[model samples]
Target: MRLVVARCEVTYTGRLSAYLPEAVRLLVFKADGSVLVHADSGGYKPLNWMTPPTVIEDGDGVIVVRKRAGRSEDRLEIRIGELLAEVEHELGEDSGLEKDGVERHLQEALAEQPDALEDGLRLVRREWPTEIGPVDLMCRDADDGWVAVEIKRVATIEAVEQLSRYLEVLRRDPTLEACRGVLAAASVKPQARTLCEARGLGCAEVDLGLLRGAREPELTLFEA
Candidate 1:
């Protein structure tokens, strides 16, 4: 069996919801500015824009499609109501199409989501551990103390509580060399931050702005 990996970056200009009542369009260009295929609106339109077949240059503001067969194509087309469908799908049948009190980001996109926690761990690699449970992240610093991180989008009290539990478990582990626990998130509650300090656990606050475009989060160590 052969597995094909699609390498494409999504640069969203408008809304990323499937519930939005508008059509979404994408422009695909070949390496030489040639148009190969335009698939959108449940149909495929071939060569409607490009006059000649050419190589599309890298970073040309167009979606470039490459296949293992050495064939490539590009298109300028709309995804029709795919975005709206996706949004609706995220809500599911039980949660109707109400947008007033619904979450803007998908549940999987939230910090509590496993993927988000893993992503945060990638940013804090120096502290990664070989074996750990389903916690977001586990790492060791120069001091050889364990740093267990839990990421949250909204940085609520519950997130801190969850991290606190993970820390408690780590503290009891005889194999874990470090005795300190760290809780990190996009934001942190005052009480949660206070509790961490009172409990002698390390605390780190991550800025979403820094995580967006910055290379990584800067760590400043202080004696706890």
Candidate 2:
């Protein structure tokens, strides 16, 4: 991941047109080929962003991101006035998701048998992409409708919010506009359940041991 603090202006043209005037902002160029421009005060949302499968041209204090969007192209241009702190970090393939051992294992287990969460639920893919981030899993229901699944070690309000964001972006695509979200976790909080119900999302408290054949993974070498 490359983080650059710069005084710059951003303009986007594609499905729509938007611009951000010159100011000090944070620009993130991710290993996944995503680019994000953020202001300091907007909570966690970026001011402008472009997702992966993009070609980025950078030189002479200007950066241009191009993507082939169907019959046309989308472009994001950044004009750098001053480049401040710029540094890159090597983050592994995790992509800031599935950070813990148990969560990672649970995702793998669920990926193998998605029907454990719901009947006829078969995985289309894992780490399904969106602008905000990737969904834990993308699946198809018995009716062949799109299902977006998010697995967490513990489900909270924030987790529900994360899944909601993924769903929002996915629904923008005409093919996935009817998509729904499901949240599976080792532990699902009451507040999270309430939020899921209100948002019309499904929630299941996944039993990790049961999913793994009634045996929890051995994380330690020594027996107590």
Candidate 3:
């Protein structure tokens, strides 16, 4: 499988140290699990500050997306510094950053990361040129069957909505007779569970404990 490694920084005010750990830890775990990449936050040591994600603050953090792929031309690497500055500017956070605001900004920025396909598995960003719209991941099995993936860092009904859209797009392809659907989230929203059941989609709640060093499971059969 292709792997990418990157390091960024966590900058938050002392007020958020408690919640910051959970957020950052979850972010690291989700990133690593999704991309098969190593992720680290520049700690408080202050000994060495390098690269784009070298700074963050309360309601704000910096992250970079890197890729290790054979097709260098297609591979995309996003510098954390650039993304951080962009997000900061977009959010207009000149003063103290709000936790919710920062989190939302980073999440939106993360969607711009690079993409790579390996071992029948693919890690895709928002910009991948896919006929099936903006897909999070496109998995192809040995039988040449395709599965559409949609991810959620925190559970929300939107996960179901996003995957539902992908399924609709996949249905347009005659080759995709039956496109499997997936919802990977840290927590499962009640509405999402209901939608998954009603729509026959596979839903999985991801956590560091479940995916620390494990590979994403293959989607064997369609639900219902």
Candidate 4:
């Protein structure tokens, strides 16, 4: 990872146009050719980012990040004013973060009882592979339609977006052209729910306890 603190202005042009006036910010260049511009605020989310499969060129004093997608392209032009600090680090061999506890347990339980997602839903396979990555669970709906299920401990906007991407790829398959997507989580935020509805994706609140074989308390009534 390479981190640079510099005074720069950024402009992005693609489906939309955005400009960041000259200011001091952090520019992060990852090993995968991804670039991120971060303001002092906004927590972890970068102010702007260009993902991998991109090319970054340093020409004279300016930096250009370009990505080509067939005939179209997206570009981020950064005009550097002054470089405050620059540092590079070599972090070798990351095993990646492991998912544990609820999210992991939930996925396992759901895989065993796919119908818990929807009536008559049968598990076609778990971790169904795709070009992007493996989907959490792939199932067949009542009508035998393909359904891609993404399980999250807490369903947020990010989770919805992730499921949307999977749907995009899954639908490209002729056999699964009509594939549907479902976002299942223990709790879903309102914003996430809205996004799911807007995308015509299904959202289900999973019962973690129930799926883990926890039964409700039995009620005993005395004669009255």
Best by TM-score: 4
**Evaluated with lDDT, which candidate comes out highest?**
2
CA shift at 88, candidate 4, in angstroms?
1.9
Residue 43, model 4, lDDT: 90
lDDT of 4 at 146: 89
Q: Quick one: how many clashes does candidate 2 have?
A: 0
Q: What range of 10 consecutive residues in model 3 has the weakest lDDT sum?
A: 17-26
lDDT of 1 at 71: 35
lDDT of each: 0.42, 0.90, 0.44, 0.89
Determine which window of 10 residues in candidate 1 has minimal summed lDDT: 83-92
Candidate 4: tens digits of C-alpha lDDT, residues 49-135 = 886568999887699999874468889999999999999998886654466688999899999998988999999898898755679
Tens-digit per-residue lDDT, 1-224, candidate 1: 11112222232222221121232333344233334322255465531333233333333333332222113233322222222221111222343233221122222233333224333232234224322224555554455545666555555655666566566455556776354565666566888888878877666655544434435666899999
Q: Native-vs-model 2 lDDT?
A: 0.90
Q: Flag the better candidate by TM-score, 2 or 3.
A: 2
Model 4 accuracy (lDDT, Cα): 0.89
Better of 2 and 4 by TM-score: 4
Model 4, C-alpha of 133: deviation from truth (Å): 6.2
Please provide, for model 3 over 50-144, each residue's C-alpha lDDT reduced to its tens digit, 9 standing for 90 to 100.
11112212223334333222233112122332221111112232343333543343334333321221234433333233433456556654455
